[model samples]
Target: RDRIKTSINISGVLFHFVDTAGIRETNDAIEKIGIERSKQEISNADIVLQILDVTSLNDEDHKKLDDLLHTIKKEDVPVIRVFNKSDLLDSSQHSISIVSRETVISTSAVTGAGLQELKNALIKLSGVTDNYSVYSARERHLNLLKAASLHLNQASDFIKSNNPQLELFAEELRESSDNLGEIIGKTTSDDLLGKIFSGFCIGK
Candidate 1:
């Protein structure tokens, strides 16, 4: 369980969080393999959360974080610097000097401090917009909007042609309108309406 990964979904986004053993001098062969595997995972990670123990602050800790940062390019992936075990240390000592105070998040696993802020940070790191439904729509609703946009683009092309296909343009406009209507619960099909309502868990 120590080297395994745990996946959790937030607002339709899946996050694979890995728990790796501390990077320390180990002569044990099995531990060495696990450490290498952990490195591989870090290399492939979309976002990294480096948790620093406040009480165990030392030059070695800083060096390890620096090495890790070098491995993961900051321009490609954002790194979240978390100072953990804040409850065990003073407020003054809870800060990380290398990173700006605004970028660093102070958290206490035992006391659940700064957890909500951490969640918001995780959602942001996952590349999701501010909220799941910015317009009070679900993931399906967003897909419909995308479809509608595509149809409108096709309609525009039809209208711009030298010998404009007025019929095709009208058809594309109709499809775009239908997709938008579906997003707003104006679907014509009873089966689609049933599926949409059931997805919201209205009666089931």
Candidate 2:
């Protein structure tokens, strides 16, 4: 009951994958925590892959899948239903009835069948092109951007006020600059400090 993260580059676009714990009834505290994290990851995902056992799907599974589909739809994330262990099924059982609008793929880990189809489907849905460049980011980057935005907003408010505190305004600007600098590895503090000192006219 844990998450295993890895990345793959397909068609020049990098995709981050987080394989989470399988959802099931559990009374164990650690397992419950893992299940909650899985739900959170699903909500935050750009695209989701729901794995199902091809050999054991039943009416109860279908009902649970329907509920999961409804929840995922609310997040507006596209999902791919992967029926794994296809090798266990007979050739006549390869075909499955359509359950939803989401793309469905049957794959066999043993014989490595349908893996290519899955990759092609991912490439298509991701809108990757020959000219595409891979760029990957994480949650920390998003949080930094949000912090920079807030500092900038505060600086803007200071500028629009009647009795604008120029010093406070400058401090907000510096704070915003520092936040952005964390992302790009450069800061304007030295330049800004020089400008502030030049304005002081200490010799006069």
Candidate 3:
């Protein structure tokens, strides 16, 4: 974390590291819980870092990668594919396509090789500005989106009917709007706030 003290400009932007963790695989129940927690963190993050051992992106690893990618996709998260240990690989044997549209950065983290390029890539991905404003949402927001979409379908069906119930359509629209308001915390309850903040660490 001390390495984060350096002052640097990236396309006229400043950057800093907030948190880091080392993932270890094990069959123990506690270890499994850690894995699940890591997965949750990735899902909730705006960007994900997927580190791959450059020298061993073989069949089994590829299959595991496929599964991991599927999970990330399902969570609608963007990933930066880091091909680590690049210095260990022979220059001529360095051709691999891990994920489509993913920004790939080959680096020897040991020697700080290609670190500058990696930092630039990350800054570009993080589209923050002096007047940056983010609209945050939760799982309830997604559920509301789904409900609104369903009501939209219902509205479409009503538009096709010979004699549509305008009252029904209006009620559906109101319910959808309420769901959305709850999602954005405009109409949310204290219970939801508790659930959300409880998931984070005490200091956060």
Candidate 4:
């Protein structure tokens, strides 16, 4: 987790630190390794917080956003899209637009603006909204869960009548089970394992 981590204790609630390297295009071999490590962290993260520098967004930033988001989307995890340095955003900044489906928050870390709202968004998306276990599950687990959920919902709609599409229902169950198996290394590929674990402890 490098020096980018710290405890944020607010109103008796303390959260563990999970930080990753900033993703960007780089030519240095050492930086490339760091980027791979960051990708690993992102794949295993609970919820991703993508912070965009409102004042510095350019064409290159827009291109990079698509690549970074592709990694997150593969896991089907919730994302908190934050626009940082809102204090520096001029009123004319509205002319520049970013298209995102996730919840967006304008934040000024220096002024503590939108800090509470950001935390609230985190708590809600992390499922602290419910009394569910907050175990840090992997990307495969989430992907499988989402697949299972989608199929299950579809199956329910088709099973309303006495004569249901048993074949389709069974197929969905199999798909969900197969996805779950991948999470436990049973059906996972060696390539996936290599990608997840081939990282050095840079600042541990």
For every model shown, what is its TM-score relative to the native structure? 0.56, 0.60, 0.48, 0.53
Residue pairs with clashing backbones, model 1: none
- For candidate 1, write residues 81-136 as lDDT tens digits: 77788899866776566643224688899999977788788888766785555453
Model 2, stretches more than 4 Å misplaced? 69-75, 129-204
Residue-level lDDT of model 2, residues 1-204, one tens digit each, is: 788987776654567799998777789999999988888888778888888899987666555545665776643667788999999988899998866778899999899999999998898888765554433244565677788899889988987899766677677778878876665556777687568557643232
List residue ranges in candidate 3 displaced over 4 A: 1-26, 59-75, 97-99, 128-204
Model 3 pairs in collision: none
**TM-score, structure 2 vs. true:** 0.60
Per-model C-alpha lDDT, please? 0.70, 0.77, 0.61, 0.64
Question: Judged by lDDT against the true structure, how good is candidate 4?
Answer: 0.64
Error of 3 at 140 (Å): 26
Worst 10-residue lDDT window for candidate 1 reads 195-204
**What is the Å distance of residue 151 in model 3 from its true position?**
50
Which run of 10 residues does model 3 get worst, by summed lDDT?
1-10
The local distance difference test score of model 1 is 0.70
Best by lDDT: 2
The digit string of per-residue lDDT tens for model 4 on 8-97 reads 543333454556667787888887887777777677767777788877766575456456768467446677777889888777774436
TM-score comparison, 2 vs 4, better candidate: 2
* Candidate 2, residue 74: lDDT: 46
Candidate 3, residues 63-136, lDDT tens digits: the string is 55446547666445556778889889777866666556667888888988778888777776887544643233
